[model samples]
Target: MPETYRVAIMGATGAVGTELLDLLAERNFPVEELVLLASPRSVGRELTFKGQSIKVQDINQIDFSDIDLVLASAGGSVSKEWAPKAAAAGAIVVDNSSAFRMDPTVPLIVPEVNPEAVLEHKGIIANPNCTTILMGVALWPLHQYQPIERVVVSTYQSASGAGARAMEEVKQQAQAILRDEKPVTEAFPYPLAFNLFPHNSPLDDRGYCQEEMKMVNETRKIFGVSDLRLSATCVRVPVLRAHSEAINIEFQQPLAVAKALELLHAAPGIKVVEDWDANYFPMPMEASGQDDVLVGRVRTDLSHKCGLELWLSGDQIRKGAALNAVQIAELLVKKQLLKSKTVA
Candidate 1:
């Protein structure tokens, strides 16, 4: 018989948190007990799971001692403070925040790219940034076919990346603009309804935003290539759900278009969606609510013989956050990697 474990979701009221709840039930995780936790303000809010209303609890009030697994997605600051506490209380935390991603003692993971890393965790495992997870799953297979030299990527991120509040704010902004009214700026500094901008994450002395650097650094970590030459330009688009990326990769050797498509199609967590005749390729609308990353537009970069260009779209809230976390939890249970200390 399979072991049914107690599970707790930190930040259960947020966008990704809610999605995590859905995926856990949909995938039929063997959850003997489930607890939904969030900030104090969110306490008492009821969330449904397997047709049962689970009331949200104060994150500060929970006793992690009874929980075997914790899926945390509150935010970096929240995770920085609470994750260690949860782990100290004997829960294995799979965190969906950037707080511990770069920590030498912590393992940053995308199950498709580095499932083994999950076994190295002391008590907490870090889920890579959403963009990193989406790209890593799509590119890792190709990188394995041949070593990659350099990667240049541009992202079209949607409102969902900012959470459900921002998603609603975009719709409100669009309606206000249609009524010839001033669009309010709350979730974002600029209007995202019909406009786009460079990623708004704080910039550093090098002029690169935090979001851009996450792609650059997290990719190298997960790929185990410390000096993997990579550059990213992240833009926030008006799309409501999924994220799209245009990637140009230079490999050690030129990979033929057919071969690259074949590799991507065969890769787990990927769906090849190309139609040259209609000029149709992976699109965000089609990728939303999906479990797989939709990839297409495979072609050779004419300028460099070793370069290949492709496009991809994935649900930011689903694969980027919820599904990936759930996958990690599943991997942990399957491999008996839960409770890293016990595994050690």
Candidate 2:
């Protein structure tokens, strides 16, 4: 048997952090010791792990010397501050924030498509944005058959991608609207209940939201195609869990819907749910709480040669953040990277 790992979960109280805790237990990740870390405000808080209650530790006070892996999901700033420190202390850090993804030195990873990149990491591995992760998962198989020339995507993301405060905003706004009261906005610039906002984050100079740019850049990095043409429009919807995207791709070689479906169905970590005759397709409600990226609504784009379109959906906090990080940690263990007590 492989050596058990000592794992630390930073941001133990947030939505994605909490989901990581559950995933660790569910996957039986060969964890010998689990350290839960959070900000000073969450110190002394109790969180249950493997039937035992564990107290959350303020990140500043924890010793990382013995930790085999650190899964961080606190936020970009927290990750930027602590990830390198933890790595310097000898733990492999799998980060769920956008802090290090574009750092060139840090490998932006999606295990199914780029597991080899994890080996080239300088101590930290960055998880791609939730939207980008699912998009790449659905496209990689096709890309392998025929290189994609260009990609156009529009995301219908969930409130959970913004964090717990945004989820509460959706719930509160929904209740107020039902009670004949005007809903107030706090987590979003506009009321999220019964509404759709075309913006997912602050817009960059190119007029694409930050979230959209993440999809553009991360996709190129994970695919190792720096010149890959990609454009995205990310939007926030009232959905509470899973995020969905409409994707159009132009490939170098022709790919039929049937062949694409076959490839997606055989791909690991993906589920093909295209059955239009049964009125079945990928939806946020069904994709919620599931680990697989659901793909459906496949059709040929009539506008261009070798063009195809599809819909992708998955739990933002799961495949998007916590679950993917945990899976990378698992890969580290399987490859014996986490077993060695070496830091680089």
Candidate 2: regions farther than 4 A off: 340-344
Candidate 2, residues 1-344, lDDT tens digits: the string is: 55787899999999999999999999999888889998888899999988999999888778888788999999999999999999998889999999999999998999999999988888899989999999999999999988999999999999998898899989999999999999989889999899999864778787988888999999999999999999998899999999999999999988998898888889989999877889899999999999999999999999987999999899999998898999899888877778545332
Candidate 2 weakest ten by summed lDDT: 335-344
- The lDDT of each candidate is 0.92, 0.91
Q: Where is model 1 more than 4 Å wrong at Cα?
A: 339-344
The TM-score measured for candidate 2 stands at: 0.97
Top candidate on lDDT is 1
